[model samples]
Target: MKKNILGLLIVSLLLVFVAVNLLTGNEAAPASSLEIQQAESKVEEETVKVNTEVNAEIPYAKDFTLSNLQGEEVSLSDYKGQIVILNFWATWCPPCKEEMPHMQSFYEKQDDIEIVAVNLTSMDVGLEKVKQFVDDYGLTFPVLLDEEDIVGQQYGIITIPTTYIIDQEGRVFQEIVGAVDEQMLEEMINALKSYDE
Candidate 1:
């Protein structure tokens, strides 16, 4: 009789414990889709913040004044409020030859951007050769002459056709080491505009 009473007491305690848990709603539940999306969005925003920090290291483009093909002085600061494509190229570089037409096409199509094509004249044969190349390609963009290689040294142009994408705020957005086509230039401009927005 005493054993039966102990078993009944244990059963009753277990039942009470379950009833309390059910009443308080202390049960595990799955997360909703909306909560998951919010968490993912937060992670994406944090990733963008980290990328922006990395870009801050190469903050601004270096300013320099050089003479264009017209023998007029042109400074990088002249296009401060515009998107500047600071292209470093030489006359003998095959890749430079490859991109001049595309650069010209992009320049004519887009009025909102500036192409500051700096010819590495010091490395090339002469100013006459640079002029002839520009004429042959019909590149109407401002072709600045790096006659003394001052700007080349400043920009660290170890490779031919090194293009720096400078934003409207004079920040170096990107550096394209080789040749770039018209489509690439368009996409880069659009991306920079979107980033600014």
Candidate 2:
């Protein structure tokens, strides 16, 4: 009698497991080609904001001229009619290092947007390190040296890898604080394009 009861319990558990799998099988199934393509093309609307308190009251980015690695003066106003990704970073920062590749990839694919990376020289190692980093990463975007942290202060950069998305009209559209991948950059630019339209 004990053996029979044990057998019945085992069969009941197997039945329950099979029932659950049958109910959830569709979710586990592989997506179709069209479904995969749609998923890849569609950008999901989600919250990507960081340091909201700092950017809440700020409407437009303050124009400032900073010398690039090549010692050429580049100003925020120079990119007024274009979307700008203004990033503040330091040489020793891990996240900043991680983000540079993605930034470079996105910059290469884009023709209308501009990426201005501001190296916080005062907080970073030095000018030589910054140059080495740019060369090692093969970055073509304009890298400005904030030797005195003046631009960093103007942009309210308390953390490394702080990126601000400026609209075509020089409005501060979004402020992302952290490492962002190429997909995230593409989504943000696509959203900005929609907003511009």
Candidate 3:
């Protein structure tokens, strides 16, 4: 009887050990997954905060004198009394291409608005390519080339396809990153007009 009782105790101890390990392993998997999700959420939140702060801080237009496709000097000071749409774009970017038509439309609809599409400096490409792109897209607005990228650097442009709406007073009213629609452009224009009045 004593030997039988000792054997039963040994089997019970083995079962308890296995059960404890299984429970701990299951708990650990869920804990790890939760940690990963929390980290992702934090990163997303931080990115949104940074973008908002940057947009709010850089809300004014800076003056620049750059050469146009025709090799003529153009100055932002020339457009001081007009609302200017300063767009920074690259020829290869798809979003930039998409926004071109909308910008053209906006330019056509408004007389007071001045649209200047500044092409970033490119050595891999030449002036002919940019001219061809403008011709193909039917962009009637003056497309300037920042061959030295000086204007880009002065504006702190870290990304392509950036659009800045500058009011008649030369203050930057809005900064848009990536592609934007015609309606958004109209809204901004209207707001600037109201401010001017």
Using TM-score, give the best candidate's number.
2
**Cα deviation of 140, candidate 2, in Å:** 0.2
lDDT of 1: 0.87
Where does the lowest 10-residue lDDT sum fall in candidate 1?
A: 47-56
Count of clashes, each model: 0, 0, 2
lDDT of 1 at 96: 91
Instruction: Give stretches of model 1 more than 4 Å off.
Output: 1-58
2 versus 3: better TM-score goes to: 2
RMSD of 1: 13.8
Residue pairs in clash, model 1: none
| Range of the 10 consecutive residues with the lowest summed lDDT in candidate 3 | 48-57
What does candidate 2 score in Cα RMSD to the true structure? Answer: 7.9
* Model with the higher lDDT, candidate 2 or 3: 2
lDDT of 3 by residue, 5-107 (tens): 9999999999999899998885544458788899998995675444333233445577888898888999988899888999999888889889999999989
lDDT values of the candidates?
Answer: 0.87, 0.86, 0.81
Give a tens-digit lDDT track for model 1, residues 1-197.
99999999999999999999999999878879998999898996674444333264557999999998878999999999999999999999999989999999989988789999999899999988898998899888899999999999998899999998898889998888888888777877777788788
TM-score of 2: 0.72
